[model samples]
Target chain A: MRQSTFNNKFLPYILLLPTMFILVVFLFYPAIETFRLSFFKVHPWTGATRFAGFYNFIKIFSNPEYLHSFVLSAMFAFAVIGLGLFFSLLIAILLNQKIAGIRFYRTFLIWPYALSPAIAGALFNFLFNPANGVLCYFTGYRSWLTDGRTAILVVIIAAVWKNLGYNVIFYLTALRNVPQAALESASIDGAGAIKRFFYITFAFLSPTSFFLFVMNTTYAYFATFGLIDVLTEGGPAGSTRILIYHLYKDFFVHSKTGYAAAESLVLFTLVVGITFLQFQTSEKKVHYQ
Target chain B: MKQVKMAVMMLIITVVLPFAVFANGGVDVDESATASIEFWHAMSGERIDLIQSFVDKFVAENPNIAVDVQYTGSYNDTLNKVKSAYKAGNAPDVFHSYEIGTLGLINSGIISPLDEMADKYKKDIPWNDFFTPVQSYYKYQGSHYSMPFNSSTPLVYYNKTFFEEAGLDPENPPKTYKGIREAALKLRAAGHETPVTWNLHSWYFEEMICLQDEPFVNSDNGRGSELPTKVAFNSAAGQKVLEWWVGMEKEGLFLDVGPGWANHRAAFGSGEAAIIMSSSSDVNRLTAALAEKGWEMGTGYIPRPEGAKGGVAIGGGSLWMTNNHSNEEELAALKLISFISEDESQIAWHKGTGYFPVRKTAMDQLKKEGWFEENPNYLTAFNQLLDSPESLNTAGGLLGIFPEARELIQSAIQEMYAGKPVKKALDEAAAKANASIEEWNDIMQ
Candidate 1:
């Protein structure tokens, strides 16, 4: 009986072993290896590796380009996350209404989310192209990507457009889970639409908002890399060169894998620090009940 | 039980019949019985059809051997695919490579050095008969490991429509920087929107390096070494060239454009831009696309600053042998290489594409056939490359990691085009790039 009980308890782990093993091999292993390589200098041509302590990190801070990229990354991250959440919540509230063809609206709203960032970047590039671009023809804006001020602005807009749909889906799902009784009670108390929404709906959606805040911040850091690559290629003097994009340049374009690893470690610490901050600040505000 | 036995017999026959085809390999494998070879090349578009036609003619003539051809994407993509294939132990029998830093792969025991293979096969072609100017691009450590293919150098591409409006002769393009500046002024006077469009940074700077006789990197004679402690691109010649470019920008004589040189070609084709500087290989594509637009096109050698020495540096890529295959497989690959390098095949490549021939004998044969008479546009690029004296620094450049160096140069150039001081931007880029070089050298040591 005891043997059977023990087997039953261990069977779940046995079934999960393959998945756990794969995750470790593909994800955790590379992460650990990258972390270890952060202390090395790599030969660009021969791909030979050697330990160099924190020289790469030191170099990262000292190099003006690297510093610029880090600042750009922070700016890109916050701007994307803030705009993505704001627009998604607004769209979600509008779509939550009992309108005609709600199903059609849902499908249409989520369509852009299905297109990959690389494709989105390409399409946006064509639209933003100074010459022969549709946007330039209509708006009379020349060299949108070549100008530093306009380049970052266009990148942020592209990010928000590409990302708002996914966040809307999350917001709509959270809104659906909101209790009808509470809303009705608030309405009976003569609460205005804005007041009810602010007190009831907003409070209820906090958990979802928090989840998306973390997720969007992460996505802004990593997933937007492909967008930058295809759109601006971190160009117009590296104005749009975010941290992950810089990491890509270091690893592939520069073939400085070790230096890239060091940059990646710095990025990892930044992300972790922000996430910890989010958790600490939000613990009191999150109302599970 | 009796029916089951009959069914089993039918199944066996069904499976065994297909084995007959399998025994012969696939139908596309081209069984000529003399050890069939697979040749993977990155040639695409019209170049694809040209290569296929050549292979077809070769197969028709050399019935004893078969040549299989496949198209991969850009040069970098081709190199990556080859590397992965080598790692996976299933590399192609023959593949195209670049004259870039890929020679390191050969030195690192990833590619079979062609000299040893030549001795073993006793099939060495006369090295002296190859184009002398194109010879340096195909070597590593004093030995040839590749055959130069689709070799090119940047040239000045002008719009005849703009030239006519500016009252300049269509036949004579600029041969000196003074002439180019004068042409730019004339075009602006004639009210052309964009008088010039060029791949601002690379073609502008690298052409100057070749024109002024300076090497971009040092030690393996610019085949990419770690010995250069500094980027000398900030030298007088480099600065002078950069200043000229900046002056053009200031005068609105040229505009910065790209998805690299190809985009510039497209802009020139669309009539949005007048003159463009690009590769000879692109002439076929440009002419094909733009000729029907009724805008006449003119070509010229890259114009130099007054009294500049040396010639334009070589552009385009080469096909290298990798060490991932067995001796027999490499031999099969060499046979395919030999087949492509023949005089007849080279003419087909040249006529079908505007790229220069890599072998001298092929050029001589093509000249005899009056190819230049038929295609007048080929003369400009051909004469420019042939007449230009080859220099170590002028012929080609080597850097520790050429792709990285290209990125640094490109990034800095982008900054300069955006109106940063050329010297300051270049100096900053040089420092960063040198640091990368030092890092590379340390690891290599």
Candidate 2:
């Protein structure tokens, strides 16, 4: 790439102004304020604030419910990612074949990606309602959603189903880019299809997998807020209550603004830590052409 | 550099466009001889059309006032929207909030108390004519904070035909916890899969506390000079209520349909449940639902313990006037609300939806016309309140954190159902509620 010189020295700075302005106004400002407010106590409705350094953090950390939600969210993210990636990759490889009506099938399969989480939650809620749910009637377990033990599985299924389209799109593109020559040459050495997929195709798709891992992790953490809120409101003995749902209840429903802000900080730190770890692992494992 | 700027602009659009689309674009009101007031409500379904019709009549009556009525979502959504809108200085002239929000709104310092506004406007609103329970429930610190709109108490609805088949008198419905349990078992034994169910709610628990003639929280059920410091529902009355409830669930006599107002209704309508406890406001819908199956439905007082002394506390929303409006706008808003509380409006509202009339004159008129005689189910709820002795508990607990407290109690009930001891669950709920109350009290101070 060639470096171009600006006709006017100040032109480049002027061009950067809008982006900087938005970044400060929307992102940096709230991020900084959230950090500051986490140390205070805030009234939800009144927006009144009082400085109580470390008090909010101490209260939440000591809360057993918060710890339970933390573990539940970690597990939920893991299940969503594991099931989501594996199924998407399998579907992507199938779609990579030359099948008749491929475009129609692909469009039908990928349509859920266009749906927001709220829509997915509502759809699942209608299907799993204990009274007259279609799926519950078929399954003969009306308490699929009302039972605390089974409701988490229902939520996980909804989350994975909603994200499947997004994951498949990436996987399909990555599958297409796997070197055909390497596969054919390996086949000449009597390598089975599964062996080739594990050796060459999988290695070539490592970077895409890593990118999706991070994206799915973030999605499980934040995007499922609406799903949990509409489907359960974190109910049935709080079985399906994830960390984001807890933060929403504290911030929006309960109006404990300072406590919610503290929760936000905790969530941000978790995400950042996970991303940092992902970077350290990606450098060694991810392949770049 | 040009390309980079364009890319950044695109990123900003992608990020900010959803907010822009979601931003409320309603017109801002101004003070003039033609006063335009915004009236936001939480009523949906057919009630939206009913409210609009009422507002249309009001607008016709007063040519100078133009009232804008918008149906915001549920009670929670409306309150949250009002809070954000209030902060942004776009608060509606008048808005609806559920009954439990009375203390929270009073202390928020953002609402104009209805009594003060009535006095300011010199309007002759017959506050005395409002049904006693409805009038007193919204009163805090000896002042009326909001105008009662759709007030209701939970009522027990039973399938009359099923009762007869089970060899129980259709005319005589259960009135005590023991009576209800016996009736439920008989109904189930008679081959009704589920005998009774109600949408899971803390309102029922709170009402049971009131029926036992006990305060729900300290400091006079949070109605005294000092706000509530801790909840008192972990007492014997609370335990008795939960034990009876959980026992029924265990016996499979009562259907544990879980939380929300819809599931239990559907269960009952489909004949999967023979009896359902729900808001008196549901009389119309439940009756019609049973009629669809060619069955007659009956209503009875919500069952209680044998010797409980108190009565039902009202649920449902009320209309609140917001602060920061000019005197003209406030007066116009007050006129709109007072019009809603008038006997004519109350009668129509009571008939259209089965929420009991809020005014005594409406009840008198309905009685004179033999309205209750023809539709006796409506009388069950009104009589339930009329017979209730007034006490701090029956007046409904006044706490700034009542919403959160209700949620805590609800989760506790679920915990009990899922195998935790009733006392243990209630105690845990009380402790959590007290923690929230203390934090709320601290912030208020």
Kindly list the per-residue Cα lDDT of model 2 for residues A77-151, writing each as its tens digit: 999999999999999988999989999989988998899999998899899988888898898887888788888
**Residue-level lDDT tens digits of model 1 in A256-284:** 77878999999889988899999999978
Fnat measured on candidate 1: 0.33
Question: Against the true structure, what is each candidate's TM-score?
Answer: 0.88, 0.92
Report lDDT (CA) for all predictions.
0.76, 0.88
Winning candidate number (DockQ) = 2
Best by TM-score: 2
Worst 10 residues of 2 chain A by lDDT: A41-50
What interface RMSD does each of the candidate structures achieve? 2.9, 1.4
How does model 2 score on DockQ?
A: 0.42
- Model 1: C-alpha RMSD to truth? 11.6
Per-residue C-alpha lDDT of model 1 across residues B1-445, encoded as one tens digit per residue = 9999999999988998676545434223232346566777888787888888877877786677577788878666666666557656766677776556553445445666666666555565677877777776565547777766777777788888779888998888888778888898888888876677776446557767778777676563455433555566666777778778767877878766634444576678777777777778777777766687987788888878888887876676666666655455566666667777777787778777777887788888888888778777788888887777876766666655667666777778777777789889888877776776666555655
Candidate of highest lDDT: 2
